[model samples]
Target: MAMMPRMELRQGQSLVMTPQLLQAIKLLQLSHLELQNFVEGELERNPLLERDDAADVPPHANGGDGPLAADADSFARAESLNSQDGMETRLGTALDNVFQGEQPTVARLDTHGADSLPVIGGAYGGSGGSFEEGPEGFESSLTAEASLHDHLGAQLDLAITDLAERIIGQHLIDAVDDSGYLGEPVGEIAERLGITSARVERVLAVIQGFDPSGVAARDVCECLSIQLRDRNRFDPAMQALVSNLHLVAKRDFAALKRICGVDDEDIADMVAEIRRLDPKPGRAFGGSTAETVVPDVFIRAAPDGSWLVDLNPDTLPRVLINQTYHARVSRAARNDVEKAFIAECLQTANWLTRSLEQRARTILKVASEIVRQQDGFFAHGVEHLRPLNLKTVADAIGMHESTVSRVTSNKYLTCSRGVFEMKYFFSAAIAATGYGEAHSAEAVRFRIKQMIDDEKPAEVLSDDAIVSKLKDGGIDIARRTVAKYRESLRIPSSMERRREKVAMAAGGR
Candidate 1:
């Protein structure tokens, strides 16, 4: 064959990933907060995109059944019901009647066993007020907490008098980490400041004695020692225990007893006292605020024993393209450059709105299928969680495994049991004995935890024993697999557990 410059036209098929399609895929995997941020950025950048405030508009004004209207209807009905004589008795009777019906409606039970009124709309169904409505209120107005550095600076200003000593103290405070451990060595600080090591040590000692007792200590053991010295309880036995934290971590109570030169009761007392001390003193002062996990989907038990899945409307980004604005701008454009800019903005805005809508629908579809597949889990508990995987869900919903994986990522579902990440429903399958059905790895882990929790101090279950118990229950799992699961659950080995139980018994006595 000779190499030649030639143009050959061939017909073929390929899936082209357009920019809009890529954007949709990217939006699918983002958590609610991330999606909100992305949308907010788009709103600022694009001229034709605006937030959908239709939710806040009254239903009567919009001439549609919106959230506000539904909420008003529900409140009206509640008031009317309340106005009747013997309303409390009638309400209880009405609930009883509703509970006996075959149709499933969203209902909850109070501590008194009476059926709580169903929530009317927004995420589940109908028109109702959204959780996103109203001002952020007092929480938004509250100031950020003082950082660890600021807190220490305030204390340092009050405690130190001399200029040279105050400068050293501030430098030492700067070296202290968020965990309240001194990051720099005394020799290093001394060398850096052209000061004597002894002077640095003295200043550090005074600063350590400042509020948050152990703020300037070098290590965990030193931190504990500082707190103990402040309490005037740094006795020899307690000192020994603090020095040998590795043994404490291993639950080697017998070794602790020997090292501390104390009886079981005294060692236990010292351990308890150490536990009462603040380990991360600086965390209480200036750690970053924990971000709340807002679930994208909700799973509720219907009255008919089926799980009802709904997308959180509050989490769903509501965006609309300003078609009127786009039309007006396009008409005002005099040149191709101006016309192109207007058209591009309109296209981008349209894609974003469609992407958001598709993202919500896909999330709802995936979540609903998950609830259907793991119906046993929601009905019962973790023990009943079916063996599931991304492929299983993908195949069931007629989507690719990668698409399913992306949908599940960073998304959470709120249910009666608790809020769990969407990925939690999918676990590797564990084989079963004989001709029995496969078990979920998660369900197996739950079983092992239950067996260990129920085990008496006198009868601690080993890995082999757990394997035997699971085998008897029709789950064909290995001892090593059980051990892996046990370790993953942060459970100690049988020996460690037995030692802890024995220590607890001795301490109680």
Candidate 2:
């Protein structure tokens, strides 16, 4: 064969990820808040993309100029028709598009002859006319509240005269967790600070007496005892009950009565007093705001006994290509740069709209498939949550496993049972008891939790016992598997449970 350059004609299909396609994929996985931020940025950069405000067109309609003809001079005139200020005014409407499920109205034009600016609605209390409605002091009050550490440090600095005691007190305060219990032992603190245990104890005792009655206690016993003493109820019975908190926790009233040398009535009163005290004093001081969980898909029971899967309108991004603006800009575009800009904007706007729609459809498809496959779970409970994986959903939906994974990732589905992460439906399979369908590990775990929760304190269920119970229920799981599941659920072993029960029983006395 001659090795020479030759011209050949061939055609082959290839997959290329364009920027718009990449954007679509990126948008698919973004949370609602993130998508809002992204859309806001796009609105700022693209002038042609304007939010669709559902207000009738102005009666005069841009100086009664019906429409511009497709001509160079008409385009030149159109260029002047939409000034930079007017374009900016249009872009301001982009803020309105950031929120979904709301009709975006035109921003009222400024009375001083400036173009109307669109303002974000009820987002961060920004000065957006009616959108500026929120609890005026709610956010400020939260921010102004003193934290646990601040509260303790202020009292320490004000009350403590000795510098050494104050220093030790500060270290001890730092050791106290948000739950008001000292994570580190007093002996360990003394070792770490080269101070005597007595000195650390002294400083701790003082810190415990801060504004919150149980601010720096070593354990629940100390926390409750401090509160009892503050209320002048630290009697022999109360002292005995406080010392044996473990028994109190397990509701061992008889044992608590014995330990406290009090009758049933006296023990009950002491227990009630202890119950009234705040175990976690630090919690009284506000902490970080809880992160809200928003579902991506909602599945409800249809009238026909079928599961209806729908995308959460709140999370779904609503966007559209402004054909009106695109036409205006296209006819007015003069130079190559201007024409290219207009064309690119039109393409991006169209692609974004299509991508959002596609994203919604794909999500709905995957979710619908999930609900179909795990229909029993929705109808019954987690016990019926079959052993599912991405491959199973992908096969059912006729999509690739990766696509299913992408759709499910960072996505949550809410149904009659509860809000659950999409991944929660999938679980490793457990071997069936010699026949029938394979068992779901999640169901087995739930079963184990139920068994433990229902077990009597005296008859605390061991892992082996759990394994036996599971076998009786037709789940062929081993002792180690039960142990692993129990650990995963953070359930203490049988011996620990027994001790806790015994302690509670003793404390009640």
For candidate 1, write residues 1-509 as lDDT tens digits.
99989998999986666666666777778987777778777878998887776453222222333212222234345445545522320011211221132222223332223333444354322234656534664557778889888898898889976556666787788788888889988897777666689988999988998888888888899999989998999999899999999889777878999998999788878888989998888888866466888788777776655555666776776777778988898889999999988878877877776566556667766786787788788878999998998988887766778878999999999999999999999999999999988999999999999999999899999999999999999999988999999999999999889988987886689
Alpha carbon lDDT at 500, candidate 2: 77
- TM per candidate comes to 0.76, 0.61
Least accurate 10 contiguous residues by lDDT in model 2: 53-62
Instruction: Give the CA lDDT, 0 to 100, for residue 77 in model 1.
Output: 52
Assess the local accuracy of residue 359 in candidate 1 as a C-alpha lDDT between 0 and 100.
64
Compare the candidates by lDDT and give the number of the best one: 1
Model 1 lowest lDDT segment of ten: 89-98
lDDT of each: 0.77, 0.70
Q: For residues 257-326, could you state the per-residue lDDT of candidate 2 as single tens digits?
A: 8888888878777777777789888898865457688888777675646555656656654556777878
lDDT of 2 at 165: 62
| Candidate 2 stretches greater than 4 Å from native | 1-14, 52-280, 505-509
lDDT of 1: 0.77
